[model samples]
Target: MTPEAPPTTPTQAVEIVRSRYAQPKLPDGTPAELKVHEFDIGYLVFAVFPPRTDAAGRPQPSPPGGAKIVVSKETGETVTVPNYPTEKAIALYRKNVERNA
Candidate 1:
């Protein structure tokens, strides 16, 4: 089967991620830096930075120990990313990345 075209502009990727990341179940927030970065593995990841109360409304500095995780699952095998939370969101991101990779 032939693969379809990837996103022609960043807007498509951004819009796709924005909708998924803003869902009610997951947290409602933006990264402290408020940036959506493409992962080396080809998926977009963003952080919902802790809220800021300072005059500027910028989130305070935070340590990024949670940026990646390494643990054994119930299968007793280790994985970098945990099980899928949003299958559709993940599939969309993967489809876009495959074009570039």
Candidate 2:
């Protein structure tokens, strides 16, 4: 098999994550959107969540423990981690990258 090409831009990186990871479904059985929660030069972290507002128009609290998808800009590779704060997720991704390097 051919190796995947590395992502050229942040937008491309997001696309990679979208294609590779499946968005989680809400209690209503609707698939949540993959939103870009954070990023740096090397990685883009996505949060799986429902819309910002509910049908009643109230703000939605972010779901607990939804997995975050991290995409590597250099390799177009991905890592999924438990729902963590952006900083912690990036730190874990960096550690994994280092270990694999």
Candidate 3:
């Protein structure tokens, strides 16, 4: 796919997150809880919850992957690297937030 323009708003960021993690909602087709946070690690990390998807495929309230987007704070800049734990990404995001604050 061709590169897209950078998102200038949190709503746009939500749209970006939903593109990959579609079908996110409750069993009754209601919207689920979603969130966006401050930027860090050269990126912005947004979480799109699945209503009930946990790390082990359990129907829990939280998940660790396939439900997050680490968009660069600037164009084409990624915070995550290959073969790293997702916790690191979160850490980096928090660090950047701290730095920016």
lDDT of 1 by residue, 1-101 (tens): 11123333334444444443443222444233323333333333344554545578866754334431111111111112332233444455456446645
The 10-residue segment with the lowest total lDDT in model 2: 41-50
**Model 3 lDDT at residue 73:** 46
Write the residue-wise lDDT of candidate 3 on 1-90 in tens digits: 122556666666556555645545666777766565545423444434445666786776443444345655455333333223466656
Task: Output the lDDT of residue 86, model 2.
Answer: 78
Per-candidate TM-scores read 0.28, 0.66, 0.47
Q: List the residue pairs that clash in candidate 3.
A: none
RMSD of 2: 4.1
TM-score of 1: 0.28
For all candidates in order, the CA lDDT equals: 0.36, 0.67, 0.52
User: Residue 22 deviation, candidate 1, in Å?
Assistant: 1.9
Q: What are the clash counts of all predictions, listed in order?
A: 0, 0, 0
Number of the top lDDT candidate? 2
